[model samples]
Target: MPISRDDVLHVARLARLALTEDEVERLTHELADIVEAVGIVAELDLEGVPPTSHPRGLVNVMDDDEPRPPLPLEDVLANAPDHEGNLFRVPAWRQ
Candidate 1:
């Protein structure tokens, strides 16, 4: 389907975009090309083909979990400009 200038303008307005005349003209043609490409894909014959999320099987490789020593409290608080005890302190927010 061909995309119209008004269609492009409507989309831009919905997106809160302030498009220039040149940009609107460019996007009108670009969006039409994209729609035509999608139409071509929609015409493909896949009657016997199974729907898939991916073309190939996926496998996740994860490292074994191991216990580790925690960083010292002083080391963790070293970079804090303002801290109360072991926690970083920030300005209180007002409702």
Candidate 2:
């Protein structure tokens, strides 16, 4: 069966929530309607059909990994806003 008004209030209290009386009543009806609809779906016949996570088959799109040459030190350092020798300098972050 669907949840009741008292059930909603009990749950809210357990979750440390503070709901008005009106909210509890509204949620009870909403939840009941949803449960009734779901009951209809559960009664349907879906025999001999395999369950699927997705409607269509999916495939990964990736390229094979390969080694490459490194860029020049001067070219890499040129993009840094601030640098000390060959190393990039960043603002202090940790306390």
Candidate 3:
């Protein structure tokens, strides 16, 4: 069941896309080929193979969470473009 040029037009209409005639022609052949190629994957026999939760083995590579000595307040605020008291100063949003 290869999709036709009209099928592409119908899909574009359904998606509210405004495709040129050339785009419709291009997508018709490309989408049809993609669908046909995907059909080949259905022929694979994977009945006995266990379904994997993740394609690649999952692992957590994280450092243990631990508190550290805090940086000096002056050192933290030293590089700020604008600061008021202990907070970074920003543009006022409301009058």
- What's the true lDDT of residue 44 in model 1? 78
Off by over 4 Å in 1: 44-95
Q: Which scores better on lDDT, 2 or 3? A: 3
Candidate 1 structure, TM-score to reference:
0.44
Model 1, clash count? Answer: 0
List candidate 2 stretches off by more than 4 Å: 6-20, 59-95
TM-score of 2: 0.41
Instruction: Between candidates 1 and 3, name the one with more favorable TM-score.
Output: 1
lDDT of each: 0.90, 0.85, 0.90
lDDT of 2 by residue, 1-95 (tens): 86877788888989888988788888889888888888787776899877788767666868889878899899999989999999999878776
**Candidate 2, poorest ten consecutive residues by summed lDDT:** 53-62
| lDDT of candidate 3 over 23-52, digit per residue (tens) | 998899899989998889778898898877
State the lDDT at 5 in candidate 1.
Answer: 97
| Positional deviation of residue 50's Cα in model 3 after best superposition, in angstroms | 13
Best by TM-score: 1
Give me the overall lDDT of model 1: 0.90
